[model samples]
Target chain A: MNGNGKKKRIGVFVCHCGVNIAGVVDVERVAKALEGYSGVSFSTHYIYMCSEPGQNMILETIREEKLDSIIVAACSPTLHEKTFQSVIELAGLNPYQVEIANIREQDSWVHSDKEKATLKAIKIVKSMVEKVLQNESLEPIRVGVTRRALVIGAGISGIQSALDIADHGYEVLLVEKNPSIGGHMIQLSETFPTLDCSQCIMTPKMVEASRHPNIRILTYHEVESISGYVGNFKVKIRKKPRFVDPDKCTMCADCEDVCPQIVSDEFNMGLSFRKAIYLPFPQAVPGTYTLDIENCLGLLPIRCGKCKEVCEPDAINYDDQETVFEEEVGAVVVSTGYDLYDLNHLGEFGGEKYEDVINGLEFERILSASGPTGGEVRRPSDGKVPKNVVFIQCCGSRDPENHNPYCSKICCMYTSKHAMLYKHHVPDGNATVFYIDVRTGGKNFEEFYQRTIDEDQVLYVRGKVSKVYKEGDKIIVWGVDTLTGRKIEMEADLVVLAMSMVQTDGVNELLKKLRISSDANGWLSEAHPKLRPVESLNAGFYLAGCAHGPKDIPETVSQASAAVAKVGDLFAQEQLLHEPTVVPVDEDLCSGCGICVTICPYSARELDKEKGVVKVNEVLCEGCGACAAACPSGAAQQRNQTDDQIFSMVRAILRG
Target chain B: MRIRNREKPFGIEKPVTARGQIVIIEDRCKGCGFCIEYCPNDVLRLSDKYNSKGYHPPYVAHEEECVDCGFCQMNCPDFAIFSVEVESGEREPAPAESVKR
Candidate 1:
């Protein structure tokens, strides 16, 4: 737009999108209508505005007609906003000077009436035309970045992220809540389809990560709090006391012999017991005994000094206390992984009451050679080999309103593996699986499931189990075969429930602390589901693994690597350029109400108590317009998003 | 559906013959009966009194028989009960027993 009351020189370019739009909307009529519109100097229609010739057409029109700004009526801006912006920027026009009127997704693709679609397309163009008249040139704000990265949760995803980022020459702090870095992957005996030993594949990575010069592995620790934005996050990690010093204590059995307290071995999924003073597992990362303070008679010397007195290295110190430390990082990758839905909630399955009924992970432990039963397929009720094992699929998944609505992506394959493993352990025995459907989407997964039924003799019943109960030494399962339309009942020695997956516990609180958005299903929400899957809606933070949704091992590793690539890209840049559309408070208009300071999710705004006004951290502000809407005095106005421009556009649309 | 009969996982035996004082934290009890079922001297039983969460917590039934094995304390899933050893002369009598004496 020009000054001194002269009409602005503007141009409009309408696209056919290869009949994706022209099939419904009359592109010729819409272009002709906008050509005659006020302030439009030139207007034309193109077969493909994003194509080479079509882009050249817009560039030629801008120079030939001496146009000030332009509008491209095409598909949704999310698809090609940057493409057209860079094109116009090359033609000596401000990137923000151009507006993309989404006639396809908003008009042509939605409306059926040709006459009405053309009319609506013209109106959409007119609104952008009016909005663009007041557009101002803006430059991206450049900010400094810290070189280090922080990875929360040392699961396979976190481990992979740490390894990838560290390999790329960036320092990483890998934090885990448990004393080990393996996560649930470590507890697993074998993986699906391939049947490769999980420990053999997992431990090498763990050892490599612990030894990585760029990676600092922090096990037995948790993120207490995290502040600051991406490129400079100040993290507070809480380190739980491991009473037994990891360095001095040579993992000997002396303390275990003297310790009298017996506690459930949680690492084995509570299937067996261990001494109060014992290692989490034989191959624990640090390989040190941690005194169970809750189960220990007391933490004082006066109470029970058995372990301390017997300790040859004198590593058992009762004075150990939790310590919180801080670190600085440029980016964060949250791959905390998922937790299995508890089987105890399903009363019909008798999962909690009946000792024979166990969960999938527990069965995994039983099949593991280092497990309590020494890898033998023995039922917990009685240490005997279970001849006929019953595996239930979709136990608490894919049943909306009653249980989890989403399918646990790994269950179908894992159940097939369980049955196959069972048949392998007991050559003479057979395994039966009750399922709604056998989903084998991964590579060789379908063949594996078929092999289980054909070679392994695992029976697959297309059904959902209604109830299960223990009678004598057998677990009776009542179900119906949907394919045969017949009700059936059977008795087996043990029953395994394939429970659903959920975002790990305390993740919601952690998301709130990080100011990261989560989906309705409570999984971490990504910036864009299809395009920006690895990035969080908030800047400098990324999502990976089952943190966003249920995913198998391969998918989790892929996502973790993708997140690492994103962090690497950010680190590759010596400085970052942030969006300059942030709102700045007009000190004269701001009453220092402090609403913007409290309402900002990113904590980008701060109230200046001395000046009785608020200030904005432009680098942190994402221009979400929260404070702009809340401003009573018309302060905190976003650049280029002033009230006058919006009124003009709304008025243009309302003008019949 | 209830099973016909049930049995405890295993029986515990006291290795020492020392007098002990039993301490019970009322609210922490979940009434799993791990302490009662595993107590070597049969020193505990489920009480008629219920905790705030509606589980019938166990109470010391035969305190004099406790031999400071700490089996009940170790077996307690909730850590609601424990026994501390006492010398013959160090034992403190209960209020009712002291009144009777």
Candidate 2:
């Protein structure tokens, strides 16, 4: 309320988050130094500014002193920026007038010397104080939402989110690149710990997703591009050529029975074969077959309409081209999931050269009820039950040099599951496992590992397998016995390498388009490691399952539900608030150079030919500052952090 | 010096019972002091004097009465130390009567 024009009174509060700051610096000394700074109506120090007492003190001070502007020095703004902003707002202060100085992470946590840390904290406070003195009142920008969500990838995580969102009475568009929605889960035979059948638990969810009234399952499609921010995104989907009419197709297998070509079946982990036009599995969500255009006989147009003549429904349409459709969605959940690490990278293990060696996923399929040999534990090379089976743990995981340096977190349990399955299938067969460490820390997970050892009589060796080579029909494994200080060797009929889990290839591109950051391991970076594990740096975008990191079934499903809760909260609002400090274009300095257009990750900019100017779409801009830095003419300026503001701040820092 | 002789076996000469002197090369030592720390006789010590690299290398300050023990050479990380057990009777040839007897 600026009814009467007067100088605005501001208060600055600096906090030492316990020893997180005060252990290395003198907090009271720094606060005393800034007591008489200009425009600082009040200055104080607190132990923990984010606690209940600390927040109440701030609100009380703001009300009692009638302070206009607020400045805080605490931990990283990522931790408690919103808490203080809300506290000040409750005290009748504008939220936009708050500025934070990150003294804990930037100053105290990294420095050892007390004097240097204290001096750094003072400088940071001074800079933030300068910025707050020049601050002006701003209004929050509101955009209407479409109240619809788009879920990418039809894996278990995506399916769970779609189901949960649709159950909440909202529309969901679930898109999958494959013809079916089961993803890698459908390929697995059994889950770990409980030894439950994978299909027994997964097929029901697939059927529910297909029949849900609020869900639209779009298979054989991909998201081509995304524009606008959360609550107002315009998404374009590219539907690849299926050559079959989905609306008219019935649950008939005539087309697959008459197809002339056969290809390797990916659903079986490439252990079996499938026709050119066939369903991924009998339990595919859509319960229909998809024609592989690359290998379909009709695509060649030589002489293959045998299925059309025999079909009563006439669902085959050979002339259907690719179609592109656009939809407006309010929020997006990225659950693209993960891919298995390739073991061929470790050439010393004779990975690809040995026919008897396979990955854990392939072994899972072999143990599945609907597997190639009808759940028979047989060696692929000779078609005989293996006398001895050896499972090698940590093939690509935890090796800093050539593979992922993080523990996969699922291999230990899955390997134990594999041993139990082997014992169940072949009673006389011997099972052995070589591992560096067994990390079975989940609920009843240690008991599961113990059951395999004590009840099933599976041998556990404590060491890493150094070398593996093929010797005729057997694979010779060489390793060291660290407990006994002896080198040991064993010959086995089959070996399974427990591979690691890694992010999909297109994740980086998707993250860039969505304006989210990822950690060093390529997992989408969470807001905080412990506090907010399900949310990303970008609002309205939540992470689920292996897209964030490797996790087993229980952990993955819990996180998926957590993501659903977040999206539901976002959809409950009538309008969404976007940061007002986005980049803006200056029409007077028009040069339509188009450099900034190409640099924007969100495609939020366009050049207007009629006026010879660059225009920015306010809804699409995410304020990443990439385009502003690329603007050579200095025509593009970001709100609140304009070029003038940043330049002045830097100059004042250098002056000190 | 006193000496005791024993009967020889085949072409071997008579055995003599005499304490041996110990010598240490300071340049090759790494200051691990396995000998000084584990010596049964407490005869060896690490010298205060340092070498080119300024490390306090071990030395045998009293070499005359050493009962040669070879424990230092076994535990050095760099394999830089070794012991030479020289017979005390080598300085002067055994008396002719003792050798013949």
Top TM-score prediction, candidate number: 1
lDDT tens digits by residue: candidate 2, A1-656? 22245665777788888888999978997788677776678889999888999999999999898898788888888778889889988998878788888988899999999998898888888777677666667777788877889998888999999999999999999999989998788878888777778899999999999999999999999998777777888899999887677777785877765553444466766555555677888888676778777655334313345456666788877777898999999888888888887667778788567766888887887788787667888776666788899999998999998888999999999999999999999999999999989999899999999999999999999888889998777789998877777898999999988988888877778778777898788888888899888888777688888889998888888988899898988989988887777788998875889888999877779988888889998767888898888898888888767677677667656654
Q: What is each model's TM-score for chain A?
A: 0.92, 0.88
Best-fitting candidate, measured by DockQ? 1
Question: Which ranges in model 1 have alpha carbons more than 4 Å from their true place?
Answer: A1-9, A16-41, A106-130, A300-302, A651-656, B1-101
What is candidate 2's CA lDDT for residue A522? 88
Off by over 4 Å in 2: A1-6, A12-67, A70-84, A100-130, A505-512, A589-604, A620-635, A642-656, B1-101
Instruction: Give the Cα error of residue A447 in candidate 1, in Å.
Output: 2.7
lDDT string, candidate 1, A49-165, tens digits: 999999998888888899878999999988998999888888999888888999999998898999999988989999999888877778988878999999998889999999999
Indicate the residue-level lDDT of A537 in model 1.
Answer: 82
Question: What value does the lDDT take at residue A101 in candidate 1?
Answer: 95
- Model 2: lDDT of residue A129: 69
Model 1 C-alpha lDDT per residue in residues B1-101, reported as the tens digit of each score:
01111121211111122477899998999989988866645679999998998989988988776657577777777888888877432222121111111
Candidate 2 clashing pairs? Answer: none
Interface RMSD of each: 12.8, 42.8
TM-score of chain B of 1: 0.69
lDDT of each: 0.83, 0.78
**TM-score for each of the candidates:** 0.83, 0.77
